[model samples]
Target: MPTTQQAIPFHLAFPVHSLAAARSFYGELLGCPEGRSSADWVDFDFYGHQIVAHLAPEEAGHRQTSAVDGDAVPVRHFGAVLPMAQWQSLADKLRQADTRFIIEPHIRFKGEVGEQATMFFLDPSGNAVEFKAFADIGAMFAK
Candidate 1:
């Protein structure tokens, strides 16, 4: 018999203009817990995945767009998929905080096979992050 392998968390490291800003955005705002850190970088438990913010001012933010669903989606970005309720709550919280959005929260591909609630915003360092939720997670990869 073949054995099934367990899923493992992913690790991502990206540049940030300032560690303090990164902490405030990913930690205080997004609520990701702080992990190990050094003078040049910090790690965060980003919704069960590990993401590191490394201080590299020159490499912080770059903008590129690709059209999708009639939206100019950011070409360089990172994000997570959350449960619907959690995603909604977070969207509300961000709105209450007066956070500027690259793309406002909305449902895309309405009534389609892969419809989902999604929002996009840039952190203080100008790095784009997207959060999305699906009504049916089983349809995540549906065709």
Candidate 2:
């Protein structure tokens, strides 16, 4: 069994086309609590981590991909690993909201690296975000 790492919350700052869009997506839709902000940027509580969205439409959105398990996984993206139920709930919520998925929610590496469910979608600014879960949390990092 693998041991969990000491959780030191991470901070990330990314580009967004619009602050209002980012707020609606990360705050209202995704349910990430908002934090400090200015005219140029806004911070969101991304599952205990700090992610600041800065106004930079030119820099927003992912453009490259790398193949992974037969999927064109976004080369640049960020997300969190959730519990199975939580992941499913969020997936349902997104679907109900009529979100356009980059990759629909589904199990990956099933029976190989344990049952892992994952999904990918874009924020209003076109920034890709992924949410996933592993049936066996301890095996998340299995090699």
TM-score against native, each model: 0.95, 0.95
Poorly placed runs, candidate 1 (over 4 Å):
1-6
Against the true structure, candidate 2 reaches a TM-score of 0.95
- Model 1 score (lDDT): 0.93
CA error at residue 13 for candidate 2, angstroms: 0.6
The global C-alpha lDDT for each of the candidates, from Candidate 1 onward, is 0.93, 0.93
